[model samples]
Target: MEHSGKNKTNGFLLMLTLLSVIAVVAAPFVWDRFMEGQTGMIALIVVEVLLVIFIIASSHSLWKNSGSGEWKLKSDKKGMRVYTLKNPGETWLKIKIIGRLKARLASILTLMRNPDAADDVGMFDSYYIDGWDPDKDGVDPKLVYYTFKQKLFPPFKHREFVVKSEFSQDPVTKEMKFNFVAAPDKLPFNKRYHRVTEMHNRWKYTPLENGEVEYEFIYDAVDPGGNFPYALANWLIPAMLPFAFAKMPKILDKEKYRNAKMDYVQEVGEPAEAMA
Candidate 1:
């Protein structure tokens, strides 16, 4: 189903490109034949200008969907490096962040289980679990449902996401992973904000030999729904991610997270102390 969606998007983009080329080539002849006098000339100029803008925006969107671009370094701050990539035939931009945290897998998992605790980080205007499927042992549930309300700058309205996330561990690498996607139907819609229903994201944690967990985040695609321009949103997202991540080191320093331990997680060595 995902492949089919990608094919449809690519086809639509290709048709749009062909149509744009035809319009550009035909505009001069149209103006020469039907246009007359200053009024006609002004109308022609206006039409051409609008067409050019449309073409530019479409071209930019096409390039991002090409999926051949390299990971562009966007930001490096507070021990994390954020990179952005445009995957082929994807509407939303993809983001990857690589960093190390002075915590164990269990600590991070505990954080994931209690996402609302991180609200103090100020990354989102509001975030909390709306629902979940509890584990039999009453520990970490395999699936969690949550929502995030992000307050955007002026002219852009707030954005919200209702998501369902699942946790897993790689048998060979022992890497802990969380996969999440927008699940709009999981909850009733709210009219106050734009709801994001197109998103696929993942987080992976690999324990390193030096007692630090290598933290990697992959935002495969996140389409902030509504009329917001994709180009502007793409640029703004990367710029804002570093600020959100800068708060992580401190969040992990809290005793609840720093001292957390789980029998299921395989530690690299002795759990390292929180970063100063």
Candidate 2:
């Protein structure tokens, strides 16, 4: 997704800072190795150059798409309501590129090396209920098991839930959609004290006239009595959403459905793939 305006500028600055730190850390060792005529000196130099080029290219791409996705709060009744808008102007080619990048980054090796690995549900999380057909799936949706992590303080926190989903169609738009409403069963820690007591993560996909698809993701959640007690979590959740949303188009672009293929095995007793 493209990030423009102030957000894009901020992201550029952050990427620059990160690259600088990486260069600083590697300079001394690289210089010494070059001076000592290390066996792999030529290879090392080539790799270093390639790494810098990659960083530059990736940063440029990100800077260009900084504002590719947008979010807005629609309501805050029992819970805060938010939705996403994938910049209407974004081209299919750009979307495909972004999706590929996401898939590559979410690959096994990358997740294993990620410091914030615990903060991801990764590829293993998927759910489907028996006898559940979307068209016939009425108001009462079936329970779905999934794992997700919440960014809390230093170390990340994880939450596993057996959430029930509800299905409905938009009256005006006739958009088919489903929403997670309750976590009938939750991890022990979350059972007693959890920021998300009630949640409605609604996903709606619309087929466009141009043969492309548009997606609208809505996240509505209640923090029962304000367990977080901070305005930051509310804001952060919306900002962090684009990443997950962005991954969907990527999967569709590849014309593959790993989750659908694995759903039966996963439900029958296969252990979920641990994110690194």
Top candidate (TM-score):
1
List the lowest-lDDT window of 10 residues for candidate 2.
Answer: 91-100
| Tens-place lDDT digits, model 2, residues 79-180 | 223443334333111111111121221232222222233334353333343444433535232233333444344333333334565444343333335465
Off by over 4 Å in 2: 1-156, 168-174, 185-195, 224-227, 258-276
> What C-alpha lDDT does candidate 1 achieve relative to the native structure?
0.73
The residue pairs in collision within model 1 are: 67-88
List model 1 lDDT by residue over 80-153, tens digit each: 89998876766567889999877667678777655555465443644445434343356456666777777767
Candidate 1, position 75, lDDT: 76
Model 1: ten consecutive residues of lowest lDDT: 267-276
Which residue pairs of candidate 2 clash? 2-65, 2-66, 2-67, 2-68, 3-65, 3-66, 3-67, 4-66, 4-67
